[model samples]
Target: MFADGLFILFTVFAVVGAAGLVLFKHPMNGAMSFVVTLIALAGLYALLNAKLIFAIQLIVYAGAIMSLIIFIIMFLNIQEEDLPAEEGRFKYLIGGVIVVAPVGMLLTKAVNSLPGSEATIAGAGFGGVKEVGVKLFTEWLLPFEIVSILLLVSLVGAVVLAGKRGTNK
Candidate 1:
């Protein structure tokens, strides 16, 4: 019962945060709202007993990614005057909802139709950091390394572009 309540609370928070992210006019405000969503998702992962995922959600997404987003936003130094008037934004939002509502309903129905399974206790070391580390290093090493390299390349490219922009100013 406690877990269920917490789940509901987290779900509500996540939804509210997502809505705030979408509805906020300023990029910084939206980014802050996104942080709330990410943190709520981490709480949900904790409720699911996914400790590593919870930590990653907080650390990688809420911490690192959000900081990077905020940094970029700050670097851009956006002002209210710089923002373009968003005419017909509400119309676009309504149109988007109209297009997406059926897909949402279909997905909900599909999930509800799935077979229910008995709750089973996980084995020892299941979802533990060490076990996940071993699997990630052994089974998923190549893909992981490729992703790391890709991130490094992107980081370097961003730095180069930023440097070029600075020099141009």
Candidate 2:
């Protein structure tokens, strides 16, 4: 009963935070909402017994990523003018459908599936930190490196966006 309650609470927090991120006019508030969503997701991960994922979600997203975002926002001195206005016309309805479609499809498919859900996810190769480390370093190493490279590119993009341009004079 307590778990169920916590689940509901966290899920509400997650949804509301996501909505706030999209609906908020301010970039800083959106970032803060994203943080709330990430933290709630981390809580969900912990509840599911995926301790490593919980830690990673918190450490990577809430800690490192949010810190980076806050730093960038502070450095850039974001104001009302810097933030983009929300798109026009039935955006909420459109956004609701966009978010619901894949999720509803996935849920429908899962409800129909006989093989996947019955198989215990907890026991399966969710393993732990050591197993995860081995796979991340060995099997997924190339993809991991590629992702890092992409992140580096994004970092460069952010730098270019924030930095003052050279004068033509």
TM-score of each: 0.92, 0.69
Model 2 alpha-carbon miss at residue 48, Å: 2.4
Q: Evaluate all candidate structures by whole-model CA lDDT and list the values in order.
A: 0.90, 0.85
What are the runs in model 2 whose C-alpha is more than 4 Å off? 81-121, 124-126, 148-169
The worst-scoring run of ten residues by lDDT in candidate 2 lies at 116-125
Writing each residue's lDDT as its tens digit, candidate 2 over 16-96 gives 999888777777898999899999999898778777899999999999989899888888998787766556635775878
Estimate, for each residue in 31-120, the C-alpha lDDT of model 1 and write its tens digit: 999899999999999887788999999999999989989998999999998877788878888898899999999999999999996667
Candidate with the greatest lDDT versus the true structure? 1
Q: Pick the candidate with the highest TM-score.
A: 1
